[model samples]
Target: MVARGRVLVIEEVPSQETFALWDGVRAEGWDVTAAPLAATVDAVRRAAPDVVVLNLHGAGDADRRALYLQAAGRLALTRTPRRPPILLVGDAGPDEKPLGVADVIRGPYSARHVAQRIGSLSRLSTMQQEMMRRVETAGQYGVVPPELEPSNQFHEPKVLVVGAGIRYFAIERTLARRATLVGAFTVDTALDYLERQAFDCVVLNMRVQEAAEFTARLRRNVDHFALPVVVLADPREVDEVDAAYAAGADDVVFHSGESAIFAERVATVLKEHRLRESLKAAYARSRDRATNDALTGLFARGFLLDHLSRMVEAAAHGGRLSIVGFRIANIDEVNRQHGYAAGDHLIRQVGTVIGRLVRGEDLAARPGGGRFVIVLPDTHVDDAAGVAARLGAVLRATRFALPGASEPVSAEVVSAVADRIDGDDAESLVARVTL
Candidate 1:
């Protein structure tokens, strides 16, 4: 299997728990490497991990601070495309919020939870790097890039609390000063609130079974799949904690009445979520008519080829890259039967669906007519095939309304996927699938 990403763990004295964490993360499809604290800088520079986990469980306060500073300094000095976020594996004190520390996983927690955090941080790092490159590329086309600095204007995050009881009150009180809170006592009420308005995150304070069900339901919806979710559970109940992570909870907080710690954890997740949203928005703003297809609102054919050439060169240094081609097999027939206008409408609708289905980092382009292509960097052929199949299925299922026909028309979509091999140029890679 293709590795999800690389993870480097720094520990002065490795323990069984640390080894177990590596094993679990490796099983979760991440390539994990362990390095002594003394070699932290060298290991990080050599491995170039997507994220770093520093274990200071047995270190003194001074030692912990020094180790973190050392790691942060090395990361700052290293000239990488994106600096990996550091995850402190031990308690870093309530008020000791150090720079460069993405998050702190305190107290007793399962390896799965840590792995999930690593995955999120890794993806965030990749997205940030991609955004920078895309912005730079767009600048070449005379598209003005969005300002990189954080906006002075602040928007209070809106949070939905789904459940009642002491934990709900604790969450509400903790976020009262920092966010806008809306309480939903029942699952139905929460779902209704979600439909009515947008929320930055959702805190589930109900029973584990109910919360798990609710999280699964939210994951099924395309709009809410990436929404942050925090499941409140009793630390003593190990089963509940496992269930929460299994159901795709972003963070499972063990409720011990420590509202301060809870607040910090929630804040970490919220910050990451907001940063991701901002990057996506910035990239969208950088798109111009010169680089985007007129009807599809996707990258123009020329822009896609230029970007793919750069990606092909970068993939030379150990990485996976895949391209997917989508063809509306019966588009010509539809145009002849119903008018060219109806055919254009059908193509436009299909393009919209492709844009919505693809990830923010994936580049989708309409090379004219019913042919579209998507470039997925850091994605293996199997995963790219899965994405292609899903897009094809959705397109096939969609019914299109024609101008004169009483019955809606259906589509026949043909999809092909190809991975970059040893000696492949952008044109050659795209041709393998599109041709």
Candidate 2:
């Protein structure tokens, strides 16, 4: 496993305890080096560590101020684009804050405690950089990331367990508290299930020969791109954790650990994944609203025309395409006599009827004022006419129940059907049907 970040330790006189602490950080897969306090700025300029660890042991106020000034100088060096996060270690409480550090660790700190603080500060810095990058990208692209609302409502999250082992069973039992766990003995089976249905997260076992490949492929898949993956490894195989992360695993858990820990890790990953999925779903809904009519819940005029254009090209290659233009025959009179509400009620009822009649492959849209259009791909003129006639007859005979109406209001539908001509375009086809 390769180290992720470099850490530079600045200590005027290195003690055994300080060296031990540096060794512990190295064990955690961080590139760490020691430098004398006098050479701190020059070392920082050369090494360009992701973070600087300053030992303020037995230092006076003047010394602390001078060290902070040196650290600040490194920020202006050409090699360092931004100031690296600094951790000040001394016998101090929260009240004794350092001038040039992101965080402070009071004395009597264990190696693990120091490493954990460094890791957290590093991750926070990474997140901040990522956010700034997203903001810049959004400015360039003219589209901002959607802000999603936090939801406390818990639905049973669906989890897919890949590969066969005792860990799978343990995960199944543990995750069942909040998730519905389904097992896939092989990667192919997992993909088949994924294609057929959506899974909120995948618990992948590192022991599976293809687990790494599976994670890569899963991330590449469009449907599962945002889906969270948690890789599980046996304690003996802890070295595989780096591979799991490289393969796009969101979190890795050792199967030998407590079942509760496994469950909690899974839950945390799921919470974040669900937040992202909510944002994406919201963005999709906003896009749909932009391209669709609010009144009829159908494609708007511009979008409908764009579809027509593509279908026309396909029709030229011997594909069948049909368009049906329909309107409420007495919509004007209904609006004049009963009011806009009655007219709107009539149109909505007609849309409902058309929606029920059209096949899943067909598109029904309220393209403009008091008019609707249905695009039937791979449909002949006769088939389109039959559909239009059925819709027209049903709409004319069915009495639409309107709000505050004495009786159900009866209405008539007038429709025209047009098939793609040899030289037809989107405009011509739509014009023919409406004319």
Question: Could you say which candidate leads in TM-score?
Answer: 1
**Tens-place lDDT digits, model 1, residues 315-372:** 7776668899999899889989888988988888888878766766788899889899
What is the alpha-carbon lDDT for the whole of candidate 1? 0.78
Error of 1 at 4 (Å): 1.7
Worst 10 residues of 2 by lDDT: 130-139
**CA lDDT, every model vs. true structure:** 0.78, 0.67
Separately for all candidates shown, the number of backbone clashes (residues 3 or more apart, or on different chains) is 0, 0
lDDT of 1 at 424: 96
TM-score of each: 0.84, 0.39
